[model samples]
Target chain A: MRITIDEDKCCGAGQCVLAAPEVFDQRDEDGVVVLLDAEPPAEQHAAVTEAAQICPAAAIALA
Target chain B: MTEAPAAPAPALTTRRAPGCPFDPPPVTQELREQAPVTRVSLWNGSTAWLVTRHEEQVALLRDPRISADSRHSGYPTVSASFEATRAHNRTFITMDEPEHNAQRRRFTGDFTIKRMQALRPRIERIITDLLDAMEQAGPPADLVTDFALPLPSLVICELLGVPYEDHDFFQRCSAVMIDTRSAPEAALAASQELLDYLEKLVEFKAEQPGDDLLSRLAEQYLLTGESTVDECAKQARLLLIAGHETTANMIALGTCALLQHPDQLAAVRDGSPQRVAGAVEELLRYLTITHMGRRRVAVADIEVGGQLIRAGEAVICANDLANRDPEVFADPDRLDVDRAARAHLAFGSGPHQCLGQNLARIELQLAYPALLRRFPGLRLDRPLEELPFRTDMAVYGLHELPLSW
Candidate 1:
């Protein structure tokens, strides 16, 4: 899966990090989205997709 | 084309439907179907666009041009008192952009899902202790006072390092701030009093650091000059009030909803962790206690749902109605604990979506099963209709939920 995120759109609600921590993280300074792994392993694909779907700001997108 | 005589605009403050306490005010549901976003008159002599449909609510909330700053000219305040509170200190949620992000990020670590999971055992112990007290006191208790209010209050106190003994004081001030009935002067005074108290506490914490949030905030902000002492205090006050009031109401109201639906209550009682977690999301969606809507002002003209929200236009995202939008949730009115309800806007959406949600989730997850298991035969002490719901307050909840086992 190809993962994409717009940091400017992140509100730091932290749902992405919660859903797939190995692939997503928040900047400690301002809680904006930080991609930990742009192409995470297949095992993390479902969680990354779920995170993208539930992101309140629609900041995360995966293909 | 001649414009037919325009109908008089509806007042947004009208009471919720008589028999349907769980439903959004009937007018809002109707608006969702017809208008989706339409102007409504407020308690004050002002008009703001009330956005009702779930899709529109979500889209608009994520629009960065919409600002939540209460002090902005077109922002709709719940009442004169709510407007007055803005003159004092605006909490982080009411802020936008870089400032709000910076302030909110400061506390995100404390509420991350991972951090909250680590604190679950401690939260479970707190719930257990409260249940023990309720059990010892026996049946026929006002759950609002005996259990609901205190559980979150105590947890917030420990989290912020504020003494639990001072709950009565802060809670009273919080009520004044949120109570739509309070006079502007009274509300202003209550806010000032709480600010002064918090300022003092922040000062004390700075001098004598502890593991609590306030002390840590003090070391991080004050010591580094990232924020002023007053700023830290105001943030603490926001956390204390939001942390307890919303969750407390949820506990009482959720329990009441469960009792009304024995099958749903049984589902929660079964305690399969996944089932219970799903139940919490369903309960949050069904009982969106922040019924006044999240108010905002459009900073730039934006077309949403085929309507143009012009710059400087006030908007209220009616979440309660949005949660029940039939286009999103099937059989929306039914209380089904197993429903997939995580997408609901109970904690709101966008940058200002509830910051304490992770903490709130754990509290509710532990609260429901613990309360139910402790009092196996729990039921309402009086007829459900006779109980007074806090409709007059900015937040929707039971004023006092009486219970018996």
Candidate 2:
């Protein structure tokens, strides 16, 4: 699965990091969500889904 | 244009400290009953319209016209204030919508009732583990240092993927920010130091992402092939600062409120989970840890509590007063565990309700009962009057609650 972050909508709460650190990260300055891996290796796909699911902003999308 | 309607209050004459910052002026209860909303002077000698009435407070806190950003409304800061209070509050809590909504959106999931419920098991484990540790340590222990303080701080740190050991650094930074005597320079300096460290962590997370929020944020947004390093650090600073301090204050103050009322404490200890839940609700109501009001700047002419608030006037919605409003609550002063206290402004009401209310609630529900049951004999080591209290801090609390079980 591919992970995506809608920067405009992300609040940088850092919840994504807690759910799946391998995939999602919060920028320290702008406080917005950023995707670490556009497409996770097959083994890490579950982490991507977790990040996508736990996102408070609904800014993360996993395809 | 039509002329503005003036405030209902006549110009007031006297300005005084009603009591310790933690203790509200007994007259505040009357303010809600009689005047509701009246223009009054703050302890720092600044002008602010205090909203004491129930409906008035609800209307004002939810109103979009009231901006939280102090820079916009000309916040009435004191002659020489510390920088920490400003740094600590400058994030979502102090911003209006758009910026506030945008920033709050990022961290929103961590606070949902469902999300917090999911966290219940972990919270319970933390409480039980801490109780074990406290029991192992024996009597005359510092509850503030051992259980009350550590549990929430540790939980928030884990939530943010921050190393628990690094807690000392952020704890120091939070202290500086909350200090009544801290100079603006001192607060700013501490803030900068923490930001700088977080900046580096963001970079490391970007190049080699880990299974953490900082790592994810770094890889996705910070490393976005464009944003500056300093910018990411500022955001991290906001997260750590807001996450831990408020929860810490709540844990300390909430425990004290329960200890002071042992009959209610016994009810919490012996009752079912439902009773514990009710007790938790009551504690939030009685304690009202965030005793201060949310400051707002009026955008245009508006009438609140039968008073016409002119544009640009400052408004302070007293949450403490709202929690104790007689009309909404039957016998508001008495701590009834089953009083349907959910409507309280403790987490606040309306659009700006505390974003962390869910997490805060779970922490209390899990921790308080385990604490009382583990040490049924727990009592204050010193007289309540002798305990160290922080009256001047933004979030007032006991510096150290000495407990002997």
Candidate 3:
């Protein structure tokens, strides 16, 4: 699965990081989304999907 | 435009049913089931759209047309104190985006999940120390005062560089600030006192910057001209109050809820760290402490859940009700510790979603398990019915939880 995040739209709630820590992180400066893995392993897909679905800002997208 | 319904709108303020302190008011559940989007009369006799379903609340709260600016004439407030002191207590939470985003980002870095995770050891230490003190004092301790309240208050004080010794003064002030029934003058005085205290602290931080949030705000915003001293202080005051009161209540109320359900309480007490974390989410969903619905105003006409909310109409997204929406959680009312309840609207949704949620989550995750583990035979000293719940306050919680181990 491919993952993408719109940093501009991220409110830094860190839901994505909480859901899939391996695939996402927040910038240390402003807590904006910091994509750690563009293509995570199969085991992480479900959590990544949940992250995208529950993101308050709808900032994360998956393909 | 959709024609108005014939029935008289119910008042927004509804009491929880007797003997059902954990449940939302029966009226709220009925509305969520029958009419998810409908008008409700506010305290001031003005009407606002009350959105209760989870899906509709998520949709409407995320819509840019629904404004969070409390200054808007149509914005619904929970109390006279809230309305009268609205101007004095204005912070980023009450502002619309671009501006809101700008101000909120200033402190989000310090509250990120990773940053908060790094504070876990420190938080755990604080919890252990409090429990040690509570144990030393023996049984029949007021957990609200001795444990729950101080845990978060101390953590927030340390994080913001505020002296924990003055908790009595600030917590007293915070009580009036959150009390829905507080007089307008009392609320204003409380808010002014906190703002003034924080303003002085910001000036002190500017002169002697420390490794804390307030110091960073002082160095980056107050000194750099990015924000005025008053603006910095207001934000600080917001964090100080928001950081402590909500989490403190959650600690106290979550404990009460868990103790009532032995199965859930045991799950939290004996569960692994992972299980404890999941239980925290369920507790947050089950006893959503922010009982006062998130207030907003419609800046443009919008249709949600088959109802037309006209421009300038106020809106109250009853998140506490939405968290209990059956569509989102199976058997929504049950407090199952193992449930995947992370999607709950306890922290709200959209851009204005709580910035301190990560920190709050960490605090709770550490607090609940540590608390139960420390006191294996923990039980409520008073009957649940006799407990004084903070229904009079905007944030729902027990005013005092007398616990005996």
Candidate 4:
């Protein structure tokens, strides 16, 4: 599965980071979220889906 | 240079404590009978105007003349540090439009009525799970500790993608963030601790990525560098703190209000889900749990309702008063459980209205029925007078609602 992010729609609400921290980390200073990988591995399916569900901004897309 | 017979310092026209300090003042009736805009004293020892009439409140709340940011309003605060003040100010609740709109737009997906309703099953399971635990623990249970408080905390934790078990730590840390007497330094330290904790959690989510709000925030906004990491952590903190604390109080107090009125409770319990939804609206209006008014600083001298508000003056738009305005509601205190609750300002009006209103409504709708049905014989363990009403906290609610079935 591949995860695509819309940077403009993301306001660093951090639901994604909380859902799948392994694939996402927001910065320490200003809190802009950082995606470690554009497409996470298969092992991250559950957490990735969880992220998609919880993103209040609908900034995450999975295929 | 002392003058004899000095004029009175500014004071709010407060009626005798309407049950408790946490409770709303008797402005609705006065506004309905007398002037819509009347002068009142603030708890901070300053004078301000209370907009009570339904129409006036709605217009004033929506007007551009009022500002939602407390800092600009000379709004009296108890936080220790300016930064701590800023931390609590992370969410758009304190913002005006454009900025507020931009911020809210990001989180709008999870807050739609449809979205909140879709989460009904999960909400039900959560409530049942908590009630089951409460039942296992037996009677004389502290509803606040066992169910009321933990339910929203857990739900918000899940929604935010933070670990629910961390409720205790965050709850404690969140305290100084909202304590009425917390100095700026103390509040900032507490806020920083939470931010630090959340930052680490974000790292974990980044590496793993989950379906939680935090993971997506990291993946989308933070990862792209549109906003800073601290900004992202602050956003997470805002959700966890405001979303959890406010809803926790609503459940506890709303439950207590229902238990106080058996007829109303029975109506909601026996009626269809639609009826319960109506009952929830009425309860939100009647209770208006977030009694603290939204503070606004008058940027330019302007006359509102009938009062002339001066530039730089701080005013609190009391939602509780707006909820009970006789002009809008008939027998506002009767708890009919079917009043035109849509007219109430509990979720507020204008651009700063609660983004979580949809979620809160679903929580209440799902909670009231599940609660009454699961514990049909549920009753308050102590009299209302003896119950610890939270006056010191930012959000007013019962501290520990002891109940037995």
Interface DockQ per candidate: 0.51, 0.07, 0.83, 0.03
User: Model 2 over residues A1-63: C-alpha lDDT tens digits?
Assistant: 666677865555455665566766656444456677788798877656756644544577777
CAPRI-style class, candidate 4: incorrect
- For every candidate, give the share of true A-B contacts it also has: 0.43, 0.10, 0.72, 0.00
Candidate 1 chain B weakest ten by summed lDDT: B1-10
Top-scoring candidate (DockQ) = 3
B1-405 per-residue lDDT for model 1 (tens digits):
122126666789637777677788887777777777787889887888889888888888888899988889998988888887785767788898878776777887677666677779888888888888888988889998998999889988998999999989999999988899999999999888998999899989989989899999989898888888878888998999999999999999999999989999999998698899899999999999999998899999878776788899899999998889788889999999998888789999887899888889989999999899888899898887788898989788999998889
Off by over 4 Å in 1: A17-37, A40-46, B1-5
lDDT of 3 at B397: 90
- What RMSD value applies to candidate 2? 9.4
Model 4 fnat? 0.00
lDDT of 1 by residue, A26-63 (tens): 77555678898998999999889878877987888887
User: Model 2, range B125-198, lDDT digits (tens) per residue?
Assistant: 88888888888878888877888778887777677667889888888987876665677788777777787778
What digit string (tens of lDDT, one per residue) describes model 4 on residues A1-63? 878876655544454664577898655433345778778888898888867654544567888
Clashing pairs in 3: none
Clash counts for all predictions: 0, 24, 0, 78
DockQ of 2: 0.07
Query: How do these models rank on TM-score, best leading?
Result: 3, 1, 4, 2
Which prediction has the highest TM-score against the true structure?
3
Locate the minimum summed-lDDT window of 10 residues in model 3 chain B.
B1-10
